[model samples]
Target: MLPLVHNELYVEFNDEKQGPFYPAEGPIPFGKFRKHKKSSVELKADRIGELAKTISLPRSALSGINGSDQALLAQANIVQMEKPKSMPFDDSPFLQSTTFKNKLDAKTAIADYLGKPLSRLTDLQIVAINMILDETLDKKTVMDKIRAYFTLSSAGHSGGD
Candidate 1:
């Protein structure tokens, strides 16, 4: 039977109706559900993809690895990419010592378009705003870029434009 309020399809199992099932999906594990987690190899593959984006790895080197776990580990070791030192809640020492606030304040047009005082913006927001604030870009362009940035960020995309 079609759900009236929620358009989810229900499965009829053993003369009983099971709901909230979608096409192309398996039966819900219900109480037996263990949260799906990526295995270590999958995690390492993800890390390799991320690191490859940041650093210029030779095609030959990547191909030579042939998806071996040891090779992937060796490549990761070669890059030496350390994770960021702190969480979002913790203040960044670099931002703390830098003059981004003063720079943002000095630009009245950019500040006005943002619709917030420098003090009101978070460090990440300030960084995004600063990154796109080229003298060539108008206030609307700047704001649009910043909007797109936050949208991508909220959608879980990371790294530069």
Candidate 2:
């Protein structure tokens, strides 16, 4: 039996030299492929710009383009063609730092303090706790609200406790 091959094509409008992605199958039609490629590149560039802004990184770090939409689109296409590998969280020194570990421990501590099963906590609750531990929220105020929501009477009254 012939193995099923997935036809994946990637293209970039900005840097035509970087790619004509054909991961599994043969080359894609240049005309239709270019249109989709350009749109994808634009979207990726916009996303990278937004992320850079959030992290306070220089825009150039995320996008090498200036004010020109054409240039931005081109750079994005080059990036897509490069098919950069995603950095694993475990490999990031920031994520592995003592401070980060302490914060993670604090989050786990909060879950333990509430006596609520970790599985029972909603995604929002987990995010809230992490945010609080990171000082993204005022600890005193956020803890009070969390305690009230969980109906936790005291620090030691965890369900398991």
The CA lDDT of each predicted structure is: 0.64, 0.61
> Compared with the true structure, what per-residue lDDT tens digits does model 1 show for residues 1-161?
95555547788978998887656656566687757889999999999999988988766686554446557788778653566798566657555532333444435655565566666766887776667764434545555676687677758856443
Model 2, TM vs. native: 0.24
| TM-score to native of every candidate shown | 0.25, 0.24
Each candidate's number of clashing pairs is: 0, 2
Clashing pairs in 1: none
Off by over 4 Å in 1: 1-107, 151-161
Q: Report RMSD for candidate 1.
A: 21.7
Query: For all the candidates, what are their Cα RMSDs to the real structure?
Result: 21.7, 23.9
Q: Candidate 2 lDDT, tens digit per residue, 1-161?
A: 85586454456666675445566545667665534445888999999999988876567557854557657677778543566799756766555434324555555656667776667766866676666666634445555666775564445366662
Summed over model 2, clashes come to 2
